[model samples]
Target: MIKIPSKRKRGVIISGQGWQRLQQAKRKMEMQGNAGESYTLEELSKITRLSSNTITKVQRRKFPVDKQTLESFFKSFNLTLIDSDYAEAIDAPPPVNRERIVLGGQIPLDSLLYVERPPVESLCYEAIVQPGALIRIKAPKQMGKTSLMARVLQQAREQNIRTVTLSFQLADTQVFLKLDRFLRWLCAIASSQLGLPKRISESWDNIFGSNYNATYYFENYLLREMDSDLVLALDEVDEVFHYPEITADFLGLLRAWHEKSRYGDGGSVLWQKLRIIIVHSTEVCVSLPVNQSPFNVGLSVELPEFTLEQVQDLSERHGLKWKVDEVERLMALVSGNPYLTQLALYHLSNEEITLDELLKTAIAEDGIYGSHLQQQLWRLRRYPELLADLQRVVLSPSPLEVEPIQALKLQSLGVVRVQNQRVSPRCELYARYFKLALAIT
Candidate 1:
């Protein structure tokens, strides 16, 4: 927020709780290294989407009494005012629509819905700069895999590593038509991100070929050009798994690079300075050749859904004072699925609906989860074979044995769970909801 200085406005005093909450937010951000005069303040404001003036006032203890604005500012900084006796500076009612529930979406970095699961967060951090480290982040979608990857990248940035995030989802269909085009595209993008000149033309030899040329550019040119280690993060890597011809070679290249880091066999100078992070939903069909797949070799981190305690923390942040029973009831329905639990709570916090109503109508066309469920429904319709498999899985009284590939696909969608080769709905809500939705199939 660009500021134009004005005459000092009289500061409004507030209750101790109100002032304390503001102080906490200021202190936390300060601890996160946002205590500078201009730059830190701007970074903080950018993350929180709150005006720098609002943050300054809150710190001065004369924060404006706008409850929603104050709440937003606090939430952005991951602060929740204890709802006991806090009073606003003005005592004026906020507009009815002041706060909008973020029911469905990617939880932004500012409003990062992260519950630190020890070991996983620390492991990913450690692996990123460990020299040719291949950190594999595997989890179903909407299960905070991307969220965790974002944090990993942030950690790398703090370590002064050159970071580049490439999403295979961004690759056009034509790029995947051939192996050469795709590999060239990959190396070119990584080179551009590192601010290195593309040396493909000079490095390419008809004898050595495109893949080797890409390697030549990376190993011979780009890696030598780097002053610090480079962290190349690839998200949505599952997209490439569908192309077996490309998947084998590309994954092998990564594994080979990782090996080079440990022993500089032929030429490993720059290879050791490159760390790779590959994030994917482990729902792919084909298993790469034993020597080719990089999954088993690297540091693998699987993101589990939020636990009950994690939900409690998130609920408190939402300003919803609920008992343990309430959280459990919500959990029984969502079964710790991060997105669904969030959907139910966002409405509950706003008093738009009760927990019971959310669960009861969650799968309904007009319910909060309607659009999200419909998206899944559409995908299922594409693969009738998969739909038939789900139909059986959902209707069965107990977990049913299913094709391994189908099970992997369903589990990846967060629609079912596979235990001992038996498949069942992941949550009570899914069982009840999909049971009705897939009845006709």
Candidate 2:
């Protein structure tokens, strides 16, 4: 007797056979009714519970279908294969077309002109070593606070002063809750910047060692490890206020450091060797005593937006060929905002559109910048009463009757400018944002 090999049990497979059988059954069923016409891709997908692309692929027989997929297709169309004659004609779908582009991350500062305040490099060079003095930088959002500080740090490095710049923006509520952890993190950053060994240990009893006092630990550590005088620039210092205890503790420490430098046992040794600079987005509102406050301790430097001349210089630097009048017109539209001015210049540089065309396209319905304009409008619309107040002031041309808080918020948002008792829109950009806000709301 010839020994016949037993058929081996194979693992489960998901084939396109069931799909082919289902398609044939559906065609036959339809032919019996009124199936003289071929089924569209949409119709096939609806019947097979697969995407149009997938059905098209199966029709091309581009690849073998798995058993599970075939089962699904059959179940979706309610069909069963009775024989092997139903599985050979399938195809794959066409490929999708996609475009990929890399974007530049850094804004070219050379192409940017400074109109309001001097360039950061100039300010940094002008910085005199008044060891006991503090420099406070305040600005609205995106007004170049970080850029200026970076320039200052660069200048400090050039001047051979040891500089340690730290930003507290990433400190969340949890990190701020534990003062020790916060101090250690700050110290570690300072250590890294100052080229000192990281001596922070979990087993350490005090955050500051014996040689360094709690208030002047940072200064002490730097002076002990490094020979040069230190320039400590702290960014986003206002964030410390998010935790009241942390804010109080940090401010108190600053006060102690300030005192030790001025009147400590070393007779101006610590104070004369240290320069502290605190940069914030806005004036922090903490409920600390007046003497112990940051407001009392530093020289306030306000960062203002660019002027028309600066914007023109920036345009030229960016290789944008614009007449003086054209530059002025663009400034009128964007209100001398450095970022917006550069953005508008960028858009304009890519095309030969006229100023009027640019503005119309930027503000028109379904235009490129229209959505951004709409978003700005929606932010103001969220406060209807404020919008109403602004409109009333604009229409009737009178002084604002709203509270100081409301007015300040509007000013901060770059919407309104207040001079003496008169309040008006800052520029055409603000007027546009406000008008859109009113129209949409």
Q: lDDT value for candidate 2?
A: 0.60
165-232: candidate 2 lDDT, tens digit per residue: 88887655677787777777777788887777876663245645422443455554556557777888
Instruction: Write the residue-wise lDDT of candidate 1 on 1-441 in tens digits.
Output: 955555443324445444444444555555577442223445656867876556445433434435566567667767774564244344333345534444554455435234555447656765675778899889887787777788778767756788888999999988987878887888889888877777666777879766677777778777787788888889999889878778777888888777777785646666888888988886556667777678878898888777787688678757788889988988987888988877777778878988888877877899988888888778778777789899888889989999998899888877888889999998887787778888855
Local distance difference test, candidate 1: 0.73
Global lDDT of each model? 0.73, 0.60
lDDT accuracy of residue 245 in candidate 2: 62
Query: Any runs in candidate 1 off by more than 4 Å, and if so which?
Result: 1-105
What is the lDDT, from 0 to 100, of the residue 83 in candidate 2?
41
How many clashes does each candidate structure show, in the order listed? 1, 14
Candidates in order, TM-scores: namely 0.76, 0.63
